[model samples]
Target: MAAYVGRGVHGQTVRLLGTRVLAGELREGDTIDLGALSTELDLSLTAIREAIKVLAAKGLVDSRQKKGTFVRPRAQWNLLDPDVVSWQVAAGAADTFFRDLAELRAAIEPAAARLAAQRRTDEDVVVLRAAIDRIAASVRGTAEEETAADLAWHRAMLAATHNEMFTRTDVFFAAGLSERDRLVHGAVHDDPVPSHSAVTEAVAAGDPGAAEAAMRALLDKAETDLRRATAMNRRAHDDHERGSTA
Candidate 1:
């Protein structure tokens, strides 16, 4: 029987294969045969090949002349790839995935905010202000609105840096940051108006130091919330394990 059987077969295959590799069910150096997968998944060789191609594109697998396809090392995996990160989270490692994301944010966002403050144009401020308005509306609006606005806000800040490389990394931030925001908005119960506004205000004022400090403070709150959420997830997982054993 196939590991996955359903509609959107190739896309499902990509997620299933990627998730297994991410969850270590298929470890580094593990080789897979396309023919074997076709037989197991009840899929055509063409389907299996396409799925493997997608995975290879994402750096999850590599094919050699004689070795077939093998799982790449975790270090070789594109951690910044949104699909990879989404698979990692879907494989039930959301706590660790998001924690690592928080650390990455801590490293990059403050500096980005600082640069945005230093380099922002009038148009940038307008966009920032519009995003902030959307976020404020999220307090009373749909979850989708909040997530969209939050993403826009973060993307705007990154773009404000005016650094080509930094702007391009918005993809790295997308899935993880959205997940983090959902967890935070649900769990922390803190009003983000003041915190988000502080950063915007600092940027608008062209205060790099204040913007950096505000961003650090914002992320510090996020990290704290994530730690709390992770602890809760650990407890829940432990409880589930104990129950299963019982």
Candidate 2:
């Protein structure tokens, strides 16, 4: 899931089990049979146990005296973990994930923009400008390039806030945002450079109010583009289904 390149048997086992849990193939409270999994995946029991330890750290699984190792309730999950986010995105939960991301951005980013406008250094301005240039250059490039540029831009914006918590939040969300960008960037009708530039310029100008407003406007456009992209994808899927039946 999520183009993960597992490093070893332990890593591979973690990915396999993590993806299954996120995909709902292994539902909440369902016991994970380590011996069975070891047999099935042809991995060592130690590998399977190590994988479970990793998942437990991520809050995806837990053990109890009577229950054995079982999937935790979704509420217990570390949703902000990059691996968790990627697995959910790969599990066809992209729509819900995108919606949640939008809401989170709406709450955090405009305020971050305001702080950035107030606190950003000259170096921050340079980084933001460079990110914008990359975004502009990648507009017509491959989806991977475009997504990377967009993520870089956002990461720069968060870094400009000079707040550790804000920067950490961006790191947590980066994986999910990358997935969203890959899906929506190709479908968006409007050029993204200008909106991003508007926010950057406001921050560079040290205008907190303007920076906040600009960021809000940018998010509005992004939400609209996401809706359009989701609708188009649904229509395409419906058309294919109809054609299959015909």
Quick one: best TM-score, which candidate? 2
For residues 1-246, what per-residue lDDT tens digits would candidate 2 score against the true structure? Answer: 243455877776787789899999999989989899989998888888888988898899998997799999999998877778878877779879988898889999999999999999999999999999999999999988999899889989999999999987785567777877877867776799999999999999999999999999999998888889888888998999999999
In Å, residue 26's CA in model 1 sits off its true spot by: 1.5
TM-score, cand. 2 vs. native: 0.81
Regions of candidate 1 where Cα sits further than 4 Å from its true position: 1-7, 39-42, 92-96, 139-144, 234-246
Question: Among all windows of ten consecutive residues in candidate 1, which has the lowest summed lDDT?
Answer: 1-10
Candidate 2 collision pairs: none
Question: Which 10 consecutive residues of model 2 have the lowest summed lDDT?
Answer: 1-10
In terms of lDDT, model 2 sits at 0.88
| TM-score, one value per model | 0.80, 0.81
**Residue 101 C-alpha lDDT in model 1:** 81
| For every candidate, C-alpha RMSD to the true structure in Å | 4.4, 3.5
